[model samples]
Target chain A: MDSTIIIEKSVIIVAVFALTMLMAMYSTWAERKVAAWLQDRVGPNRAGPFGLFQPLADGLKLFSKEEFEPNTPNRFLFFVGPAIAMSTALMTSAVIPWGDRLHLFGRDILLQATDLNIGLLYFFGVVSVGVYGIMIGGWASNNKFSLIGAVRAASQMVSYEIAMGLSIIALLMMTGTLSLREISMQQAGMNWNIFYQPLSFIIFLICAFAEANRTPFDLAECETELIGGYHTEYSSMKMGFYLFAEYANMFISSTILAVLFFGGYNYPGMSWAVENWGVNIANVLGFGALFIKLCGFIFFFMWVRWTIPRFRYDQLMHLGWRILIPLAIVNIIITGTVILRADIAAYFGF
Target chain B: MSTVLIIFCVLAAITLATAFLTIFSRNPIHSAIYLVICFFSIAGHYLLLNAQFLAIVHVIVYSGAIMILFLFTIMLMNLNEEREVHRPRITRVGAIVSFCLICLVLIAIFINSKPIVGEYVTTGEDYQSIKVLGKILLNEYMVPFEFVSILLLVAMIGTVLLSKKEKLQK
Candidate 1:
């Protein structure tokens, strides 16, 4: 209701939007750079200042190019495809907490866009809807390769999501909260969840890779198999939207991985910084810390992508249903037993 | 208040309409997709309920995982535009008559029953959490919890038996 509060909320929203877009943009550049480095070649060095403007150049290219559509029956669904991709990609950021509240101009500015009690669930819901975009795009394209790509994507995301959800159960049991902010707050300083639930973290990390359709798990649209996968029929900005969504998902999932299992903006000396420097400066550092952590996860994504080969379809299924799901169930059981130890202890009288 | 009510009405319509379309669609694949729309509208309802967790889980389980399975079945079966089977006129008539009869009976029961409005009781708490759900499932609903494992085992065996290929005759 207050003017300052409104301004601060607007500022935070704008900042997060800017940050997500910027990250998605740079992800394109980073992918190119990493790909070039992996292949031992010079990646885009001709743009503004060591290819810093490469994303801009790429954006311009997408815009300037002729947008073509196949002579398909369903043009409406075709158009809807990329819109779904872009929107679903943007929507998942709603529940993520960017940082602790910033005390500015005598008002507390929450760093999150929205704090639904079930923020984690909301993230999963939005992220799961992301597959529909690809499925619709591929099916609507009326191309076999595109259809195959869509099927692969549908199967892959659905398969991996189970493991991802199960892996989170361990942390949820430990933290006893579904709110992303609460999860972050629980991880004060060195009490980051990775120390307690390393296996769950690893399972989640792998599942995140799978869910994002990154390497090894990226059997959905491997170039050798599906020829540009689901977006084979798309061109120009439409194609760009699909790729942009992928990179944006990568960034968001990495941010989540950092926040959930890693200490999420909580550095060792964060409280010290808050006490000595101030909330704004400390939170600035916290934001920086989160970014660094996020970058590490992104690099890890690219690193695994370049290092490993794609799994065979059967192997992918085996990993998802047989391996990851079972592992996740075990992790949940272990977490549950650990959490209810007092009750168990009382029952045993030991 | 009117705006919120209007929005709720539109969403509820979309939800129920899509759900009807899901079951009514002749093509199984179309049914799967309409089911997705139905899930989305339910998530909207969950947003209204302030049960963000259930909404997300609903999407994750039903829209994400379960629908994917349905889609996979459709794809694996290759249910193209041509393969749809049309039921006989009598079967169709029977279905329609039964559906209408059921609806009428439900409406009649509702109209005939005495109105029982009780005191408005607010939960006023975060009880629908994964943590709380787990506790309740393990403690109070342990019998049902254990029964699910047996049910899954029977289903698995049934599927294996049903899907077993016939022996070759030399």
Candidate 2:
């Protein structure tokens, strides 16, 4: 409630926003570069030194392109679609714990923008709302392909969300808290959730891929089938916003994955580092650790995208509903049993 | 008056306006969108009361899951185009009569329960936090909660049955 606290939070929010946008922008370049490397071709060396500034060039091109609007009845929704996508894509970072804390100007600064107790639910809520962008855009365009794409996206996201939520429940059973910061702290050092809840991690990873609409599961935007999918009618920076929102969603998903399963900002010898190197240095290294993990997940996303083929609509539905949901439920049952094993043993007089 | 009061008033205004817009919107998709906004404002009201868990769950359920389904149905039905359907005079009269009856019943209930409601009081207790809510749900409201789950399961089964492909008849 203090003015300084307000100022501090505002600074953190701005920094996180800039960081998210920067990461999303560069991810486009990285995706191209990685695709090229995998396919054995030169990606974008002409733009600026191995195409380091390719995303910037791409941004310029998108910005300068002629804005095109379809002859649709719902002009307002057409505009609202991309705006909603872009904003919701950027909103998920508000609850993520980017780092432990920083000692600066005689104050301990938390790296996250806000630490809501129900951070996990907030993430799910925002993600669920994200489907509207695609649905509204596709419908507003009044194109058949766009409408099909939007319907596919809505169904895919909704179906996958159940499994995703179930998988997270297993992890939640282990953590006993919904705050991402507490989850990060629980994974201090090499004590990651992945070690204990590997099944949960795998299910969560698959669901993350599905939720982000990334390949192997990107049926929503299956270009060959849906012809650019939901954003087929979009052009100029409006189209760019949809693409940027995808990358931003990918980046946020990777961050969530890293923070939940991987030891987020928690290196193996973090205690030793904190003891010897001091809090500031150790926390910086922790932040660096988190960065490395997220980047690794991002690269993994792109790697899978290039390597694997997309799923058929039926197959996607089957995997989500039949396989993933049942698996997640089993994982939850297993986790509950393990956690309460001692109680069960005591009750059984063993 | 206070910051909380101001926020409550703003949220209330949004909730009311969006609710009316949802009902009055010509396009089904627009109506769905307005309903989403209305749901969000109601969630905001929950947040205003410091019920963060309830607010987020409200968002995830109503705005996120249920409304997406609503929009999906609306979109699939292709209700974006304006269409006029003739209604019988009897149907309109019946609707109006039922609406008035419902309103009268609601008002009567509110008036009758006014004394029991008394005044708003803050207990300053950890009653609405997720941990406490979970405990209360599992312990105190355990039977009703289980019944709700059973009801949902039955509905899910019924939906599957209703949607399942019929067998070929000779």
Candidate 3:
């Protein structure tokens, strides 16, 4: 209720909005560049200084192009489809801890949109809502291919989210907190969780890849089969919204993976920096550390996209239910036994 | 008169309205979208409860993952408005009546309980953080945690079996 908190929250919201828009912009360029590099060809060299402005150009093109809606009976639902995708994509960033606190003008700035106690849960909830956009877009398109693509994407996402949730459970148990800020704090001064819970981290990494719907898990939009997947019938900016949402999801999920498992906003000798450089400078450095971690995960996403082949539907389901879910459960059990041994002994009167 | 109270009222109204519409909408796809709106509104309610964790889980589970399954089923079955089977008038009336009774009972129970509201305590430690939730699951609720694992396994097997079609050769 304090003015300072309100100001801090507003600043964070603005920053996250700016960050999401910027990431969505760059991801378009990045996807193209990655595709180009993989095929051993130069890409988008002319747009604006090494194709940096390609996303801008693409946006302009989409806007200029006439919006096309098929002769679907439900006009209201048709428009709602892309709006759902774009809004839900932006909503997930609400809980991401972009940085540690930075002191400015005698007021401490929290470098996140909203530091809810249930930050991870908030992320999961937002990510889940993301499905509506795709489903709506596909269903409203009134095309068989679009409908099929929607079906495929919906199934793929739901199957993988279970694995993703289970994977996080192991790390959550290890860190003993859900607030991303607290998780980041616990990972300070070289006590990164990846060292302690590598299995959980790996499973999380895989689930992250799947959740993003990148290559190998991109059955939703396989150009060969689904003809551009869920957005097949979409044209112009409506189409752009769907694609942009995908990248936004990718960027947010990457940031999450960094924060949760890779010592978000923490680095070696962070204490030394705080002691020497003061709280503001140290926190800035921590933010830089988080940014670096996020970029690494994003690059990993891109790397896997370029390298791997798509998973067959049956194979994808098999991995989710049979492999990833079970492994995640085992990881949770192991984490439980190790952390709760004392409590277990006490409970048994040992 | 508090901002919190006002926000809660708005969110609660939106949640209940959308939830009511979710079941009432003749078109299943429309019902799905309304359900999504309902989930989001519930997430807002969760925010009010200070159960940010549970709210997010609710969004992720009900809105994101579970709704996707519903969407897939709807699409795969091609249950558009044209193919949608309308409910019989008598059955529809019964459903509405039963729903009203359920709501009335729930409201009555809630009003009668007058649950003592706790003061908002800023626990220096976030007890419900994902990490803490994990710790509690492993340490305190370890048995239920294991049970959930078996539950998922059974669910997985059941889904595969249910979806499988018997071939003429078999």
Evaluated on chain B only, what are the TM-scores of all the candidate structures, in order?
A: 0.64, 0.76, 0.70
Candidate 2 lDDT at A173 equals 87
Best by lDDT: 2
**C-alpha TM-score for every candidate:** 0.88, 0.93, 0.86
Chain B TM-score of candidate number 1: 0.64
Tens digit of lDDT per residue, candidate 3, span A162-220?
88888888888776667888898888878888888888888877877777778888888
Better of 1 and 3 by TM-score: 1
Task: Report the C-alpha lDDT of model 2 over B1-170, residue by residue, as the tens digit.
Answer: 99999999999999999999988988888888999999999999998878899999999999889999999998887653446666789998999999999999999998975653343224445676789778868996799899999999999998877667353231
DockQ, ranked from best to worst: 2, 3, 1
Say which docking band candidate 3 falls in: medium
Candidate 1, B3-83: lDDT as tens digits:
668878989999999999988977676677888888888888886866666777788888877787777777567786686
Candidate 1's displacement at residue A144, Å, is 0.8
Q: What is the interface RMSD of candidate 3, in Å?
A: 1.8
Which sections of candidate 3 miss by over 4 Å?
A342-350, B1-9, B12-16, B49-51, B80-170
Query: What root-mean-square deviation over C-alphas does model 2 reach?
Result: 2.9
Q: Model 3: DockQ against the native?
A: 0.65
In model 2, which residue pairs have backbone atoms overlapping below 3 Å? none
